[model samples]
Structures are given as structure tokens and as C-alpha cells.
Target: MLRCHEVTIQVPGRVVCDHLSVVFEAGQVWAVLGRNGAGKSTLIHTLAGLARPAAGSVELQSTDESARGARARARIVGVLLQIEDGTYWGTVAEYVLLGRFPHSHPLMGYSRDDIEHAEAALDALALTTYAGQRFATLSGGERQRVRIAQIIAQRPRLFLLDEPLQHLDLAHQARVLDLIATRAREHGAAAVMVLHEPLWITRSCTHVLVLAGDGTAHCGPADEVLTRERLEHAYGCRLREVDYGAGRSFVPDV
Candidate 1:
């Protein structure tokens, strides 16, 4: 499981979350919701151990033993950021192969199992044909999918995705989310995704964490915490839930 204890995350002149704590269990999906500049990314990074917390601690304890240090932690937590920042001069296949580095020995190359995992991830993301294509040549959406594919290839115990739906069309968004949810359930992995549209927190997510942008946060089961009041408070705007008998839809009150 992945857990944070009284963790405080803050940047210069900006506060994301203060003395916050949460835990993510296997076979569950959690979404982080809030307005822009609400320190969503900062909080995600802190939880993933990519960034240091101002106070307290973040720990990951496997079912049997503990994986200590950065290298061991990397073997368990897979992170995908909002943007693919660095310039890559390699093929899509080559880039995806990097995900296996955590499990490899020093000065080691890709093993047969590693290649197989990368190929499976590529197939799952419908990028098998593009495997030979240059990573830089792919479009924004394509690059985003490849980035996600890399994570799948890693086969980590916990997934940390920040704004994963960026640069994708509606179809790809749904497709990618489906794959993420399926993978988590099948592998008994825990997924924590940062999403912009709270409305898209589909049935796949079991829990939620909403940042109020006021140095506070709220969390609970999805059905209980994803109410209009909580969402409006987090976004600092008025929104209404329209009842359509079978379900409810979230939209602006206007």
C-alpha cells in the first residue's frame, strides 16, 4: 500500500496541501480534483516521492516486505507527468523500454521479458504499429499515449498519473482510462490519477481527494464526497447536479 502521514507540501509563495494524509490500496482508483494552481501536481509529486514533503513522511509497504530507497521505490511507483518535457531522439519502442530500467541490473540491456512487456503494453494502447516510429515524430496525443504505455510496461504496484487526459480526444480519453482501470484491477495495483474534469471520475474510481485551494482537502468514498457542494467548494464556483433518474450529471449552475 501507498501512504502519507501528516505530509505538508508547499512551494514558494504557494501552498498545495498542509499536513495532509491519505492511503491508496490495491485494486482501487483514486482521482485528485481541484482548480488550476490548487497544487494538484505538487501534491501528486509529493505522494509519488518525486518531490520532498515539507514535513512528515510517505511510505510504501508491500504485502510481505518493505522496499526501501529510491531505486526500490521506483520499482513499485510508476509516474506519468502532464507533459513529456525532455527531448527524445529514440523510437517509441526504445522509449518504452526505459521503463524496465528500474528492474534491470547495472550495465544491463533489455531482457526478453522486458521486450515482451513493452510489446504487450504497446498492443494494449493500440500503438503496436507505431512502435517503430520515432517518439518525437508522434503527435501530442500519440506521445501522451506512449507515455502511458511506458508506465504499463513498467508493471508497477502503484500508478501516479498527473493530468493524463491532456492532448487527447474524447475517444482516446475514454480508451486510456479504460485501459488504466482494467490494468489496475487485473494486477491488483492501485492507481491515483489527477483529473481536470471531475465529471469524468467514472465508476472506475473508488475514492476521491479534492483540494479546496485554501490549504485544505477533503476525501472519502467517491459516492459520498463527489457531491455538488464539495465540488463547488473545491472549484470555487457554483455547479449543479442534474438528476436524470438513472444517474446524475454535474454541470455549471448557469
Candidate 2:
């Protein structure tokens, strides 16, 4: 549902990716893999229309992303940034309800359907018990789950998640990954996530994007792009591949 055309992303002294052309389609879960400072987060922001690329353009559903109004865009594209402001002083339920802002009427506020969506999202994330808690009082992992729940409530056609597994425990991580994968597989939503773990990609992602942090990138089906050589080069380290019943797993040689 999102396409990047010859996109060039740059940081202060480094070019993240150059002439990067890729398409993220419905029913696919994509993983963006890279070392720290490799511009994974930058690329996500650019794709979400929160940042501008040095060259080329990004399109959502065949139209220029930047051309759409904020609410209109939010209705189709949901984003979870790596970092979030901690200034929100609302209750957890209130905070989650904010996800419906795009769908809410300016004068009428959130509808019953919006509340149902938000409640279901919270339940999916296992945050039903914490609905009355203050958002700032929750633990890091809990907060992360809440953020993800907010996005789920939005029910966007495309999900752009930057480090979605951050601060999450193994169980929560699996839950989140499965949730994303299920959304793509069953609901036809597209997801592009910045993930540090290769095993998780093998478990759930259909496509892969590997960035070498030098303006070079590899993108294709996960099985084809996640070869030992490319992963080693992109990660700048040695990895041992292990055969598993479901798929392959890459572990650090060290």
C-alpha cells in the first residue's frame, strides 16, 4: 500500500539509503533490518510522511503521501515512532481513545464504534486491567503495548512501526509479532517494522529490507534477501545459521 521511488535518505554525515525503490503491499509483513545509526527509523518516518527524503517520493495507495490532509492520511496510515513524548497527562483509556481522533467528529467526539475499537485494541494488547491507570505510571513495556494498541484502534490500512519490539519481553514480543502478522495475513493490512531480531523476521515477516548504513540496501522476499552473506554484510558481523523445522534462524557467531 506504500511505495518508495528512488528514495534517498540522509542524516547529518551519512546517507541511509540511496535510490531505494520498494513497494509494501497488502497482506505482507516487511522487516527493516540494519545496525544502529543505519537510518531505519529515518526511513520509517519518511515513509509515514513525517520526514522528507533527499530525493524521490513516497506514495500511499497510488497517490502522493504529502498531498493528503493529515486526518485523511491518518485514516489509512498508522505510525509508531521509536520515541514518544512523555508529556501526556491523561489516563490510559483516554490516551488510547486519542487514536480515534482521525475518525471522530470534531464536534461530536468519539462514537460507539470508536470506543469499541479502542476497547478491543486494549484487550488485544492485554491492557484491559490498566485502563484506569495513568499513562505515565505504566512500565516501559506496558507503555509500548499501549502505543501499539492505539495504532490497532486506528485500524489503518498500512502500519509503519519503528522498533515495535523495543522494551517488550519475549512473550509480549511474540504476541506483538503474531498480531502484526495476523493483521496482514487475515485482514489484508500491510506492515513495515524496524526490527533488530532476525529470528522474529523469519517467524513472521514475508519481505525484508536490509540497510548497510552506507547508502546501500537490499530488498526482496524475506527468504531471498536474508541470506547469510547479505545479513553478515549488513550487520557487519559473523552469523551462524541454524536449520529449524519451521524456518532458519541466524545467531551471532561470537
Best by lDDT: 2
Q: Residue by residue across 1-254, what tens digits does model 2's lDDT show?
A: 88899999999999999999999999999999999999999999999999999999998874544537889899889999999976989988888999999989989999999999999999999999999999999999999999999999999989999999999999999999999999999999999999989889999999999998889999999989999999898889999999788889899999
Indicate the TM-score of model 1. Answer: 0.95
The lDDT per prediction is 0.86, 0.93
| Clashes per model (N, Cα, C within 3 A) | 0, 0
Per-residue lDDT of model 1, residues 1-254, tens digit only: 88888988898887788888888888889999899989889888888877899998988868635577777788899999876589899999999988988877767677889999999999988899999999999999899999999998998989999999999889888888888888778888888999877556844678899998988988778888788888888888899787656556588887
TM-score for each of the candidates: 0.95, 0.97
Clashing pairs in 1: none
After superposition on all CA atoms, how large is the RMSD of candidate 1? 1.6
- Which stretches of model 1 miss by more than 4 angstroms? 64-66, 243-246
The superposed Cα distance between candidate 1 and the true structure at residue 226, in angstroms, equals: 0.6
lDDT for model 2: 0.93
